[model samples]
Target: MESQHSSTTTARAARAPLVFVLAAAVCAAALGWTYWAFVQTTTGQFADESAWQEAGVAAPDTQLPFLRFLDTLPTISVVIAAAAILFVAVRRHRYGAAAIAVAVIVASNLTTQLLKNVVFDRPDRGVATLDFNSLPSGHTTLAASAAAAVFIIMTPRWRPFAAAVGGAYSVLAGVATYINLWHRPADVVAALLVVGIWTLIGGLIIMRTGNRWNDWQGFGTGWASSRGWLGLCWALGPGSLVLSAVLYFSVQAIGPAPVPGTATLPLFFWWGLAWIVGVGFTLSAAAGWLFADQARRTSARAVVP
Candidate 1:
């Protein structure tokens, strides 16, 4: 029976990385679709415009001060956060976690810049807008990567809370960028996707390294369970989608009229921002739960006499 259990655990452990990889692929494809739809399609351009105007309105009244703070949240601050997380992992002797954390941060940030500057070109999609590309906001990417670093280093037990707090912070940062007109919703979403890909890569590395400290106690009935975050993600993900759809169709019913800066823009802008926050937080929470669960299972196996 012990031998059978060991084999089962090992098999499950082996499958986790594959699951993460497949999920990563889906996120990448989603990001591509987002680009093609919003960047290339006419309707997408309108939606982008709406989102931008909405952000501008919100920036001055509600989000400006917050945006300024986030804007001033320097690259060094992100580095310090990553370093602190890395230090915790190293102190716990989780070298694999430390390395993966750094990789996720460095690789995700570099890829965001590369895509914005070099690898991907934003053609004139006929939208009357800024000339430069801004599909992935660097500020949002930095915030999200720092969050990912935190999620990567934490043990399974702490991940649910981390998921809630870190995911919220990242989502807030992304939304602030939109409100401040730093980037569009697609830009923020793309940054989340980029961080997500590196997160999967980092997960794969952690699984391979087989760090014992990564494990956690099994789930319980409480709200803090690994299952709790997963459930919250499910709720938030679908709920946000439904709300966004409602907003989109309701605005569409009004028809594009009056003027550019008045009616549809603000409505569509909020709609796009809603989707961005939903997608960003849902993905982060789900990924956090995935790692936490995997760690719990692996740790459980490791402790068996």
Candidate 2:
């Protein structure tokens, strides 16, 4: 009886994170598909082309100076991620997790950039307004990097949860770029696809190597305290995503989206509903509450370490 009970407890503990990662994947695919083609599929609307064309708006390439500056985000994200892996190496002294994190982050980021320029580069309508491989987005790629990096070392079950949180942030990143006019609706969709495909590849690698997923363990707040990190994430993470989506879609519905600085803002509105209400807050809140509820019962059943 004692051995059986211990085995059950161990199994449950390992299952949690995998659940989160899976959940994230579902939410990402659903939401991503919606923004990328929800209305169009149902109503035959091609806003990316129609919205601007009817209004005589023309899409333009990223400006040289700004493009040069913004192009550094991928690099910055990579550097920060490298340091994160280094910290894990020096502190935990775990080569497995450190190596996986470093390798996945670098490979995924580089692959996305290369695909962006090589496979996706094209001039539509005598200009680079659109490209074929642009279906997956790099902004979302970075977002995935930030989120997936955490999960790659964790148990398989935790992915859904990470995806839940990570996917929201990924969507938020896409929206922010869209707001800043850095990418089009299609670009955002492409970003999500890119991240999903690469991250899935990474997950498969982990699975093949037999590394289990880890629970968030939740980061510390800016005060450098674990509790502080939880508090900050609890307060700002959801809220920030909500605010960012609200603003993005609100602007989207109001104007001629797919065009910069003067389109609709309805998309932000849908974004809020999908993320804050659908996944981020509503679903996430319920998930967190349930996880906490389960955690207590779980703790009573087994030793953590």
Q: Score each candidate by Cα lDDT.
A: 0.75, 0.47
TM-score, predicted candidate 1 vs. hidden true structure: 0.87
Give the Cα error of residue 179 in candidate 1, in Å. Answer: 0.6
Give the alpha carbon lDDT tens digit for every residue of 1-305 in model 1.
88767855674564367788898998899878888887778777667766786667655686768667675766644765667675776677676677778888899999999988987766676667777778888998898888888877776666776777677778888877887777888888889999888888887677656555654676656665556766676677667867878888888797853443467346777687778878877786678767866676666665555
Per-residue error at 115 for model 2, in Å?
Answer: 9.5
TM-score of 2: 0.52
**How does residue 78 of candidate 2 score in lDDT?**
64
lDDT of 2 by residue, 1-305 (tens): 87867755564554355544665576457545644362234221244433223222222343444345446656756665676667667875656776777666666668667756665443334221433434345665686576556645543234335435554565556545544455555555544544544455554444333422223333333333233323333554467556656654554466434432244334433342233223233332333333433333344444433
Native-to-model Cα distance after best TM-score fit, residue 271 in candidate 1, in Å: 0.3
Error of 2 at 22 (Å): 3.8
